[model samples]
Target: METAARTDEEWQEILRSVRRVHFVGIGGSGMSPLAEILHSRGYRLTGSDVNPSDNVDRMTGLGIPVSMRQAADNVGDAELVVYTSAVNPQNPELEEARRRGIPLIERGKLLGLISRHYSNAVGVAGTHGKTTTTSMISQILLEAGQDPTIFIGGRLPLINANGRAGSSDTFICEACEFQDHYLSMTPAVSVILNVDADHLDYFGTLENVVASFHAFAGLASRAVIVNHDDANARRAAEGIPPERLIWYGTGAGLVWSARGCRLEDGSCGAYDLYHNGEFFTSVKLGVPGAHNISNSMAAAAAAHLCGADARQIADGLRDFRGAGRRFEFLGTFGGVTVADDYAHHPTEITATLAAAKGMG
Candidate 1:
């Protein structure tokens, strides 16, 4: 029987046993953040990805060896091997690890194990806005002097990278639902921005998706922040206590709500933020988009629950322009506005297009 670490102390023992760690499919968005965090912690890290990306180069520049080709030689005396769900079963590195009886852990389990070290672990979960909302929360914590360790799915401009290793015990990261990855996390504060039908290929049905979100909410130890406008989100958060739940939306009534939109000139979205029927403050987002208003409200609600003042929430969001490749403006060509984005999912694409329409 193979034993796995169940607690932070147990995981620490596992870490001490290994001198170097190898990651398969390391260039991936999900795997790269963990690699960066581990690298910053004085671990000898080696990785291999089937495809090459700018992130691969970034990791190499950080003194972590990365190989574009996957082979058995890449494992190279690694004590522990971590592989993403995307890695092929026939991959030579994986086969070598199995043959050598090296302990192999999946990506989600590694993330959950790592999160246990933080006193305040905020897992931002949603079908659509996990990256955006995670970035917003990171910015808020930064402004409030929390010095949080951030691991976002997309590149955040505020952090100047997709992830950062902070000295503080506050860890903020995106909890993805695909393959029920969020199930591994036990967060101090869990923010459910919204729940929509997605990743059907893995989840099989919409009911399973709702159940997964509910499970994720139940794992929150401190507070559960959700979008009141989304019914799926409300149902999913039913596992948590009523008093522990903090609702944020553009709805008529909620714990945190944004009202009085000022999107006339596409400069910035100005709104009066309300908390429990009382005016909190006037907030102006540096980023443009009506969806961003809701995202900001969610971030502010989580930040406030975590002891951030109104000023920190406002200023943090004000400084957050946007994430890299998230509706990023490229130079125009021949009187045509050119922009680049990583919105591949249909729902994300729809939201991105809607935001683009609101710009003019």
Candidate 2:
């Protein structure tokens, strides 16, 4: 299992040992975020993509070298190489890395270390809403004056920055459940918004997938906030040392839940929060979708558990509109509607389409 925070010694060792590192798929969403974070940390970074992309351009602007094509020579001067799962073992660049005996790290491990550095490392794991939920949480933290170093799977509009290196002890991150990637982080608090079988290519069955969420929930030393409404989420988080379990539902007795939920102007989500059955406060989200109301509850609960005041939570939620590629309106071709989202899996597809249903 992954721990959210790493010791100073561990980080120092990584810094001292890894002088130069290269990324195999630089344009990838996950890879680009980590590359930028490492570049900010002052590691000599070089990466390659199959073609030019906004990610490649952004990396170059950060003083890191990027290439449109992958060459064996790209790994020449680098002492270590990192590659995503998409890169087959037989790939030319990966072959070179092995031949050179350069320490090869999987994409998951690289993201794990970055997650460990944050004082508040949150892994939002579920079959759906990981990206949107992470972005919503990030927006709330941003509004509350948390200079959090946040990394979301998609682009968030509020920050106008994909990843920010903040001075505060708070660090907000999106922990991916694909291939059980969330297993790498040790979060102070872990949020299980909901759970269902996903990434069929990785986990053979839904049972195995639920077990993974259970394992992740157990990693939360402080608390595990779960969607009480989601039987699967509750079941997956069953044995979470009673005290470590915090439940949230739709206006139930859970610690956090949405009350009076509604969409505003068909562009944003609005809802009132009730804490343990009492009218807590109201929030006007800058993003669309009714699902975000529940997503915001989970984030607010996690933030509150991490010591963020209610005002901070409200401010962060208000300021955060949405992330990039998450139902992002490209341009309307007539009234049919054209939007882009970073939902690659069937589960993601279902959730997004469901959100879209309210439109008609």
Candidate 3:
């Protein structure tokens, strides 16, 4: 059987083939979003994970059955099975699916398949800031009233979850690079936020990581949006033609650049946005950090490429309050504002700390 469906009708037929879907490791962040999306799409979803998690409870509340332990019995009546990358072949549910000859789909491949159903699929990818940038893009699209279906790596306040099912044909998602999973996606527009020396455990080297990113960009059917300041990101997008490539940065010779960027209210940033050496708009970020400004630029560029106007871009960035755990402010007490962030990389930490230090 052909795994990929080239047309929406073909994709619909593929989905119609499976009535009951089973997911292994359904409690995971990556798996949970897909489960939610599939469930919302009218699939009879059943899942099993190693242990119970908040995600399991969430899925259960959604009326999807969730088993606490993974077992072959959990695949009961499932016509199709989906598994995360972390799942091993020895997993009883997976083994059962194979034994029963049920069609199996991996998480990334499933995302790709779902993307094909949409007329416009925007994939945000990078070594870091994938979550933040994806959230930003989602916000811009939402603010523009585009009604984009979004699958973000982080929980966005606007959606109150990691995924939002929209009626429009536009779909936005974070394209993860770990294990080269992003290469599976079929995006109309792809954004490469930045490429750095990370995820070495999987790719083994920066060169391999760049190659993977290049392949990701090559998958874009419409346009590839890349960061002009990041050499690695620029290099990876070299295969795309100049017309197909849209560059955004804070340096000379770029398509989009920020001018007069400065910290505002001790945390946020105020900047003048430029597109192709012409003043586009003045953007004042709701979230802090120059890094966020860059993220907003990328989001703006993507939304613009997809037809969002300047006002929508400005309003979107202004409305965005930042994703969960990324510079998330807990509360303020005794003249001290408590905040939490999930920055792991050194550059991420630096940006987060810099924003925190400037907070009033």
Candidate 4:
């Protein structure tokens, strides 16, 4: 598959035009990354969050001005404003941005625009496994010496480092389907790790979850990988052209399959992988779980499709420790490892428990 470049002249103009920007609700998971990206790109960034968090602390430390309150005064000197969906239109800063006629874009659109700038951008989308899958892909990219910019909804452990300055065109990020932001990404190679019923607050129903993924998969100009093991995922890929869809699962029609896997006896467990009906390699994942095994396959399929070598892919997968708040071992307090995961949804809870049981 050919690499995707931003063809939209308007998007290019936005990136070019953003010099100093103000963020409303800047401490959020989504907003922090946008702030980081813009700041890294030399944008004079100012932001306000209702409360202070580590993310906000990090931004201010980077020299971006931050306000503790969402005052309209925060937007006074800004030429542009960025807001997350969580930022209500009633937000004083947001309203001020509107009154000043400054450009206001959603956090999702900014992230999408950031993704388009990378040549090997892989957007991992699913109702679950997004952070884990993204971390899996990032580990692979890093182990192989591929300097890819990385971002996940949860912080990853292997990267020990949160994000990096990539030397290559590759950038990997989790494309959350909530509020239909996953559709904003221009993915050259995308991975739909799984499709489950989630985000009922926005998507409303299981059918809507599948529908959003369908719309997202349709946005893929190159390859869209799906999980053959997931029925919803299979349905999601139904409309995608056969050539554009890559499936991964147990001995199946998918491009890649785990075939059979047993956790290796080590600090980070391992698995044997298969690609295109052939034994590919013994992939020692830096993370654990049957779900992660599947994520590894998806990452490999996307990386392979995007021109990364098998050896590099294997290294990246091996180096990925785990994502932040994702089964993270918060030091054994009393001979018991308390694993913390940011999983709140039903499916996520099940997977987290399963991963913990597997470790035990």
Q: In TM-score terms, which candidate is top?
A: 1
**Candidate 2 C-alpha lDDT tens digits along 227-337:** 888888988988788878888878466777787778776646788888877777788886677777778888888777656777778888887756788888777776787
Model 4 scores worst on lDDT over the 10 consecutive residues at: 1-10
lDDT of each: 0.83, 0.76, 0.85, 0.76
Which residue pairs does candidate 1 place in steric collision? none
TM-score of 3: 0.91
Backbone clash tally (model 4) = 8
TM-score of each: 0.92, 0.89, 0.91, 0.89
Q: What is candidate 1's lDDT per residue for 205-305, written digit by digit as tens?
A: 88889999999999888889999888999899885898889888888778888889776456457899999899888898887677777788888887786
- On a 0 to 100 scale, what is the lDDT of residue 237 in model 2? 88
What digit string (tens of lDDT, one per residue) describes model 4 on residues 254-316?
578775476654334566677777778878886766667777788888777656687888887
The deviation in Å at residue 111 for candidate 3 is 1.0
**Tens digit of per-residue lDDT, candidate 3, span 113-185:** 8888788999999987889888988888887778878888777888777777788888889999988888878
Candidate 1 wrongly placed segments (more than 4 Å): 1-13
Best by lDDT: 3
| Candidate 2 worst ten-residue window by lDDT | 1-10
